[model samples]
Target: MATTNLNIRTDKTIKEQADQIYSELGLSMTAAINMFLRATIRTNGIPFSLTLNEPNQTTIEAIEEGRRIARDPNVKGYHSIDELKAALDV
Candidate 1:
């Protein structure tokens, strides 16, 4: 089999973390990177979707409010699924 050298640049902190993880997994950094490259080539793209978007603040606030409401001790509990559905008018 033919072999080639590949060069990549990444954040120092991230690289250090990856090195530690790979070492613990019993793989050298070069072997781990080569495995990733081989998988990418086989799939013709990244193995999974990569996103950098932040969560919507309004949606997060709504979820937090719902959690607070759910945790209220005085909140009424439904006796059955049917009762809960009826209470919600659903």
Candidate 2:
């Protein structure tokens, strides 16, 4: 099989970091790229997940509020599920 050269433009810092990682894995950059290309063709799409894992604004607000409540000494702390149920009068 004949292989052709592929050229791409990327940040110098990113290339350096990737080079270090590929070296650590005992692969050259070319081999790493070929692995990624083969995986993309086999999968018929991008090789891996490309989604945002960040929480939405509402979730961020709730997490912040929970942290504030945790630091507030006046907020009652429950030692067990029974105590929590009793606090809710359930």
Candidate 3:
């Protein structure tokens, strides 16, 4: 099979991490990329599912509220599980 070079831009850290993973799997970067390309061609598209794993608006609002409470000095903090359980009356 005739092959050509393929250049792609990715973060340095991401490349380093991928390199480690490929090394552990007994593959080079080129081999890993070729496998991905072949899989893509076989599937007639991307070989893996791509979707947003984002939190919903209500969850986002709750996370922000929790952060605000954490930053507020007036908010009560329980130091132990027993204390938390007592506060919750459980």
Candidate 4:
């Protein structure tokens, strides 16, 4: 079988954390990545469903408000992805 080299850039912290996790799972990082790539190719995308939790009335209202605020043309200085994610406490 032929082998190819692949390079991906990620934050150092994330890479370290992933390495630790894969080690604990008794897998190498290369093996984990290869598994993910094979699954993606087989399904033409990610192999799992991702669904958000059902929002209660208050959560729904907050989401609607956030959408309204985001839609405002005058709104300025949108938060960075990480900042928004932090704000959502996710």
Candidate 5:
């Protein structure tokens, strides 16, 4: 196989962050980029989801309420699923 060079310019901070993450994942930036490109060709697309699946306002409010409940020690927490079900009178 023959090889060639490809150069790209990216934000320095982003590149540094990506390099750190790739290093931790046992890949160099070059290897990571090649993997992404190969996957793109294999899948005939970006090879990952690019769409936003954000929750709506009501769902966001409910999620926030759940978080609040999770942080409250006064609210009871069951040690087991059965206990939770029993508390719910299931």
Candidate 6:
């Protein structure tokens, strides 16, 4: 198989970070780029989700807190709307 050079311009910091990460993963930048290209072709798309609906940090923290509360045995749980309302004095 024949190979050719591909040149791209990117932010210096981003390139540095990518280089470190690829190095840690035992891949060259060329190999990582090849993998990404192959996956993109195989999927007929970007090979990952691209979305604008991501939650903010506050929302993420709130979700984690809610999960923690649900799992904590010491936290009070109400059986129904009436019970929850009574507890909240609503």
Whole-model Cα lDDT of every candidate shown, in order: 0.91, 0.96, 0.97, 0.90, 0.97, 0.97
Residue 58 accuracy (lDDT) in model 2: 100
Better of 1 and 3 by lDDT: 3
The TM-score measured for candidate 5 stands at: 0.59
Per-residue lDDT of 12 in model 3 = 100
What are the runs in model 6 whose C-alpha is more than 4 Å off?
56-90
Predicted candidate 6 versus true structure: per-residue lDDT over 1-90, tens digit per residue: 999999999999999999999999999999999999999999999989998998989999999999999999999999999999999999
Candidate 3 TM-score, true structure as reference: 0.61
Local error of candidate 6 at 33, Å? 0.4
Residues 1-90, candidate 5: write the lDDT tens digits.
899999999999999999999999999999999999999999999999887999889999999999999999999999999999999999
Better of 4 and 5 by TM-score: 5
Best by TM-score: 2
Q: Which stretches of candidate 5 lie over 4 Å from their true place?
A: 56-90
Identify the runs in model 2 with alpha carbons over 4 angstroms from their true place: 56-90
Alpha-carbon runs more than 4 Å astray in model 3: 54-82, 85-90
- The residue pairs found clashing in candidate 1 are none
Off by over 4 Å in 4: 49-90
Please provide TM-scores, in order, for all candidate models, with all chains considered together: 0.57, 0.64, 0.61, 0.54, 0.59, 0.60
Better candidate by lDDT, 4 or 5: 5
Candidate 1 Cα misplacement greater than 4 A, ranges: 52-90
Per-residue CA lDDT of candidate 3, range 1-90, in tens? 797889999999999999999999999999999999999999999999887998889999999999999999999999999999999999
Worst 10 residues of 2 by lDDT: 48-57
**lDDT, candidate 6, at 68:** 99
Write the residue-wise lDDT of candidate 2 on 1-90 in tens digits.
Answer: 997889999999999999999999999999999999999999999999787999989999999999999999999899999999998999
